[model samples]
Target: MQNIGKIVVVAAAALSLAACGQQAKTETAAPPSSAAPSSTAAPATQSKGRECTADDIKTTGKFGEVPTITIPDDCDPPKKLITKDLSEGTGEGAKAGQQLKMNYLLVTWSDKQKLDSSFDRGQTFDLQLGAGKVIPGWDQGLVGIKQGGRRLLIIPPDLAYGEGGNGMKPNETLVFVTDAVAVTAA
Candidate 1:
């Protein structure tokens, strides 16, 4: 009879420990699918009170112009690069090693300062995608974009200039509004 009672107590303790382990997993573990940014991942439109996509962000100039941007005051920059399509294109999608002619407006994430504008220069910027001519964010963000599409890239520092900024500031997160004007085969 005493042996049976001891066995019951031991089983109960083991069950209690097992419950704790299950609880820990549920509380701290995210699904493997959500761990990395994928092309299919939905934009975190709910990140702040405002959406980070180009159309949702406040602009100062006329519609379709190279407008000044206003970032949400309460939101922190994302830890990973985020690509959101502001307007989808009907042309061929971009691929690695392809030459892309794009119009871009770059703004520093911290202060919303305009860093670069291809529109102001009155010419589309050309680069070979995934060929190291630009930051990793541009390479990755341009990969799946179609010609004539407008994309918004929210690039974390690591994907942009990293700890050493691109003559702007160190560890600066960059926001780019890019329009894929043309794509040529590699």
Candidate 2:
């Protein structure tokens, strides 16, 4: 079973590589289990090529379910990180050094492409806050998120993968809708 899991991981990596048309460097690795969903189909809404703001991005879903994220066709990427809590959660906020179990949907700001989603996999991604386990945007933006809350993060290149972008476009700004399912001490 472990071998099967490894095979699946390898196959998923290969598919991601093929989709991006290049090999991803180690420094650009995304969160664990960052596989693309079976379907890469475009969203039902077409972009009207309007400038996007934090308000332009929309999300609809209940906590613990996969969220639907809609991004405009094109937008000027923010120069700094922007974090907004769409729905506030109860209990203590997540802190650095704690483990966060989250469901997230990642999209690019440039072309509004869906890059990765934890909801599609029917699993939550666990990572230690500020542990360097993931990108800087996640490390910085995800702090203080309470359980059951949904947060929107608009990350510029510097806070994200920078020039590498892992399998993503170079210097791509990333839009993430993250649902904080749980938080525990690491």
Which lDDT values do the candidates have, in the order given? Answer: 0.55, 0.63
Model 1 clashing residue pairs (backbone): none
TM-score of each: 0.66, 0.72
Worst 10 residues of 1 by lDDT: 1-10
Candidate 1, after superposition: displacement of residue 185 in Å?
0.8
| Candidate 1 accuracy as TM-score | 0.66
True-vs-predicted CA distance for residue 181, candidate 2, Å: 1.0
Candidate 2 C-alpha lDDT tens digits along 149-174:
99999887666655432455556677
Q: How accurate is candidate 1 locally (lDDT)?
A: 0.55
